[model samples]
Target: MAYWLFKTEPDAFSIDDLQQAPQQSTFWEGIRNYQARNFLRDDVQVGDQVFIYHSSCKIPAVVGIATVTKGAETDPHQFDLSSDYYDAKSSKDNPRWVGVTLCYQQHMPRPVTLKAIKADDAITELALKKAGRLSIMPVTDAEWTHICQLGGTE
Candidate 1:
């Protein structure tokens, strides 16, 4: 199965939030970036594994694992005038955003901090290391395994 890294700001929606959600799952939404949206709409799929990374935190890290329990679907918020993520230009006939449902798998045995990841030359190709700002991105098998190992989850 494909692997991915999904970044979220802890204060806004932490791993704990997902764990506490009904069925330990939530619909991933509010993605406004086209590139990230494309990944969700095209590349990501049901059964895909994900590394839930905590960004914009004191110690940004991959704190947990998730599984894509549902494939991509139109993001309903994009059509809601009251929603902050609404796109006025978008219409029901031609939507501009999409999201997927992810189920909480497990917390990492230990967090794999960005600092620790950046220090490993073997994982230098990671988007986080390459200065990527996208909230959602793909991850290679090797990178996933290495990071999981470092996090004591392998």
Candidate 2:
């Protein structure tokens, strides 16, 4: 299976929230960016491994792991009137956004900080290093293994 990294502002939704979620699973939603949306719609799929990254925090890091339990589907929030992620442009027959469901895998023994990632020579080609603002991004197999090792989760 492929590997991916999904970022979120910890204050809005942290790794702890995922751990506490019922069944330790949650639907990944509200992605408005087209590129990130495309990743969900086209690439992300069930059984894929994902790194839960905490961004916009004091010590940004990859805090935990998750397994994609569901594949891409129309984001239900786009049709919800009261939801903050509601989109008037999307229709039921032709949805504009897509999302996936991920189940919490395990917390890292040592969080791999962004600073540490950037400083590592082995992971110099990691997508997270180049992905400045994209919330969802792909991670190569080698990069994934290396990062997992770094976090003491391998």
Candidate 3:
């Protein structure tokens, strides 16, 4: 299965939040970037592994692992008038946003801090280094294994 990294601000929706959700799962929504949206809509699939990375925190890091439990589906929030993620121009028949569902697997033995990733030469090709702002991005198997080792989870 393909690997991926999903970034979320800890204060907003941290790995702890996912771990504590009912059944330790949640619909990964609110992705507004078109490119990030496309990844969820097209590339992500059930059973794919996800690295839950905590961003905008004191020490941004890959904090844990999750498994994609559901594939792309129109984000229900896109049609909710009261939802902050609502899109006025998107129709139910032609949805503009999509989301996947992920269930918490396990916390990393130790968080692999962004600082540490940047210093690792073995991870030079990670998408996070090139497109640091994307909420969701693909991960290569080699990079995934290396990071898992760094986090003491492999």
Candidate 4:
């Protein structure tokens, strides 16, 4: 199975929120970026692993693990006029946005802080390290294992 990293604002939706959801699963949506949308739609799939990272916070970190319980599908919100993620140019027959469903796997013993990630050379090739912003991004098996071990969840 492939690995991925999904970022969100902790205050908006923390790992605890996902853990407490019904069936401990939630649809990953509201992605407006085209590149991220493409990954969510075409690359991500059911049974793949995920690192639920808390971004836009005091100390950004990977706080938990999740599993993609559902594969890519049209994001219903893109069709709802009232939704902040609505795309007026998008149609039901030709959706411009897509997402997947993630189920809570387990929380890390302690968050693997961005600082910690940066401090390690082994994971420097990670997209999170080389790229500035990406809501959803791929992760190599080595990177995933290293991070999980560092976070005490391996």
Best by lDDT: 1
Overall lDDT per candidate, in order of appearance:
0.94, 0.93, 0.94, 0.92
The per-prediction tally of clashing pairs is 0, 0, 0, 0
lDDT of 4 by residue, 1-154 (tens): 8999999998989999999999999999899999999898889989999999999999999999999999988899999989988899999888899989999999999899998988899996688988849999999999999999999887
- Which pairs, if any, clash in model 4? none
- Cα-based lDDT at residue 130, candidate 4: 82
lDDT, candidate 3, at 48: 100
lDDT of 3 by residue, 57-99 (tens): 8999999999999999889998999999999999988999999
Give the poorly placed runs of model 1, Cα more than 4 Å off.
Answer: none
Q: Which stretches of candidate 4 lie over 4 Å from their true place?
A: none
Alpha-carbon TM-score of each model against the true structure? 0.97, 0.96, 0.97, 0.97
Tens-digit lDDT track of model 2 for 61-129: 999999999999889999999999999999999999998999999999999999999988888666778
Scored against the true structure, residue 116 in model 1 reaches a CA lDDT of: 89
lDDT of 3: 0.94
**TM-score quality measure for candidate 3:** 0.97
Whichever of 3 and 4 has more lDDT, that candidate is: 3
Which stretches of candidate 2 lie above 4 Å from their native place?
Answer: none
Q: Give the TM-score of candidate 2.
A: 0.96
TM-score of 4: 0.97
